[model samples]
Target: MDFLKLPKRTSGNRTYGLTSIADFGTPIGRLTNILDDYSHIIDIAKIGIGSAYITPNIKKKVDLYKEYNIKPYCGGTLFEKCFYQKKIPEYLTYLKTLGIDWLEVSNGTLDIPLKDRLNVIEHAKEEFHVIAEVGSKDCNLEMDITKWKEEMQIFLEAGCEYVITEGRDSGTSGIYQSNGQVKSELIEELVKGMDVKKIIFEAPTSKHQMFFINQVGPNVNLGNVKLDDVLVLEAQRNGLRSETFYLEDADANYVNQTPTH
Candidate 1:
C-alpha cells in the first residue's frame, strides 16, 4: 500500500472532529485504571447521566479529569432532569463550584421548547462550556429532519460549541435500530446540506463507527465511546486498522493491477 493513499487523521486535544468517552463505572477507581494506560488518547471524559450522584467524591474525579487535561462534564439526562425540576440554574452553579467548566444540555427525556432549550445553553455558558444534544430517549420518538435543523441552529447560535447527534449510549434506538444499527439513509440525509463538522455522532459500536468513518470520512466527531474501545476507534478514524479500510485497499489494488484485461 502506498503511504500517500492513506488519509491523515486528527490528533487528540482537538476542538472540531473531536471524540469523547463516557465513564459509567466506579468513578475514581475506574478513572485511575483508564489513565494508568489510556489517558493520553482521550479528549473528553463524561460522568454519564447522574453518575456523579452515585459517586460521592465528584470533586475528586473532577480534579482527576483536569489533571490529565481531559474535560469533565455531566451527561445530558442530568441536565434534562435539572431543567425539568426547575433547578437548571442551580445545577450549573453547583458544577462550577466543583471546578467543572463543561456542561451538557439535552432534551432527550423531556419536551423542551426551542426557546427554552437555547436559554439553557446561554445560561450554562455564563459559567461553563456548553454542548447540546440532539435526540429523544423514548423509543416512540420519530425522525423529523425539520425539527433537527431548527434545534441545531438554535443551539449553535446560543453559544454552544457542539450539537451532538442522537445515537444513544448503544448507538441505537433514536437514530438506530433495536440491534444497534444506524439508519444509514436517514444519517446520510441528516448530514446532507448541513454542517457536518459541528455535530458529534454517539457511536458506541464498531459497526456504527465504521459506517460513519466511511460516509463522513475519518475525521467525523463521535461520542459515548467505552474507554476500552479508545484505541480501536482511533485506528478506525485514522485508517490505521479496521477491515473496512483493508477491503477498500484490496479493491483498489485489484482495479489498478496493471489492467491486463
Candidate 2:
C-alpha cells in the first residue's frame, strides 16, 4: 500500500517547499558523496554557525553544493555576530563573494529590535533570498505566540522567504518540551493563522520528526537535519520508515477495506 508521498515538490530552487541540510563540517569529499547520491533530494546546505570560518576551505565547499544545484546558506549566528559588531554590510558583501545565494537572519541569541530585524531581512533580500527566524535561544525568554505570529506575517509581507521555527542544534530547546517532543498545544497555536508552507519546523530527532509529521503531514518543511539523515528523512517522507510509514500503511488498507463500493 502507498503509505507516503515524499515532497512531490516544485523541484529544486523552490521557494515554499525545501529540504535543507545542516553541514556540521562534513569533509568536502563526504559532501560530494552524499550530493552525488541524492542531489535531487536536497535543496539547501547551511554551513551551521561559522564552521566554514574555521575550516577555511569555504570556496571549495560552496562550489561543491552549487555544482550539485544545492543552494548554500550560512547559519544565522554568524549573521548575528556581524550585526552585533556593526559589520553587517561587509558580511553581506562577503557572502556574495563566496557564492552564497541564500542566507538566514535570526535573533536566536541576541536582542534584535523589530525594525532592525526587518532591515536585516530587507538587506539580505537585495542580494540573497533570506529565511528569517523567529525564536530565542534562551528558553527563559518566554515565547509570546501572538507577537511571533505577527512578526512572521510582517516578514512575509516584507518579501522574506520563510520563518524558520527554532529547534537549535539539539531539538530539546525552544518550542520543544524538555523531553524532546514539541508542545502540541503550542504548535496548534503557532499554525493557527500562518501559512503552513512558510513556517519551517525544526524536527531534529525521530521523536520530533514523528510529532511534527503526525501533526502536519509528509509535506511539512523541517530544518536542522543532519547531512547523513537526509535520505532517512526522505524515507520518512515516503512512509518508508517502519515506525511512521507502517502506521500510515495500516490506515490506508483499513480505509480501502471500508464499505465504499
Candidate 3:
C-alpha cells in the first residue's frame, strides 16, 4: 500500500495551511464515510450555513470529525445571522453543546464594524479556534487588494488562527470575478508583502481548486471543498491527477532512450 510514495501533505492538526471541507447537509452516515475514507487529508469540516440545525445527530457528527483530528465548526454566515438576530450568546452556547471549539467570524453579508470584528476575534480566541474571514460576499461590495491585505493583517493581529479569502461556495465573487475566474494580479499582489501561508482561499470548484494549487503550490490553504471531493483534491495535491501533472517529480532512475542507427 505504501509502494507509490506521494508528496507529503500538511498534517491535519497543523496550526495553519489547512484544507477545509464544507459539509453541506450530508447525512451522518455519508459524512462519517467521507471522513473514514479521507480523514488524513481533511483538516476542517465546516458545518456550512445554519444548515447544521437540520442535521440529525449533529453533535455526534461533530464528535466523529474531531475523533479523526478534523476541526468541525459552523460557517460564518450562521454566526452573522445569529449576531443580527441577537442570538450571539445563544449561538455560542449551542456550539459549546455540540462540543465544537472552532469558530468562523465574518461579515460578508452584513456590515460589521472593524472594532467589533476585532473584538469578536479577541473574545472568541479565548474559548475557540477562530478563523476570521475578510471580503464581502456581495459581488458589488468589492474591496481592492490593498484593503483586503490590510484587513487580513488586522484580523491576524486580532488573534485569528487563519483568515479566509471570501470566494463564495459558487466560486464567484470576493477574490474571484463573477465568472469564477481568479483575479491573478490581485492574488499576486496580496501575497507579495504578506504571510501567504496564513491565508485560506475559498475555492469550491475543481477549476478554482486547480488554479490555486497551481499558483500557490499544493500546501496552499483551501476551503469550501465538498465532502465528495476530498480524495480527488488530495490526488491533485499530490500530482496524481491530469490537472496537476506538472507537479509530478521526474523519474530519477530513467535513462534517455534514443534509437541509434
Q: How many residue pairs clash in each candidate?
A: 0, 0, 0
lDDT of 2 by residue, 37-149 (tens): 99987877889976766766888999998898888888889989988999989888888889887888888988899899898787668778888988877756667778878
Clashing pairs for predicted structure model 1, backbone only: none
lDDT of 1 by residue, 84-109 (tens): 88998788778878898888888788
Error of 2 at 92 (Å): 0.6
User: lDDT value for candidate 1?
Assistant: 0.75
lDDT of 2: 0.75
Clashing pairs in 2: none
Candidate that scores best on lDDT: 3
Candidate 3: the clashing residue pairs are: none
Q: What does the lDDT read for residue 9 in candidate 3?
A: 53
Angstrom error of the Cα, residue 20, model 1: value is 0.7
User: Distance (Å) between predicted and true CA of 196, model 3?
Assistant: 1.9
Any runs in candidate 2 off by more than 4 Å, and if so which? 1-13, 246-261
**lDDT, residue 20, candidate 1:** 85
Ordered by TM-score, highest first, the candidates read: 3, 2, 1
In terms of lDDT, the poorest run of 10 residues in model 2 is: 252-261
Q: Give candidate 2's TM-score.
A: 0.88
Off by over 4 Å in 1: 1-6, 246-261
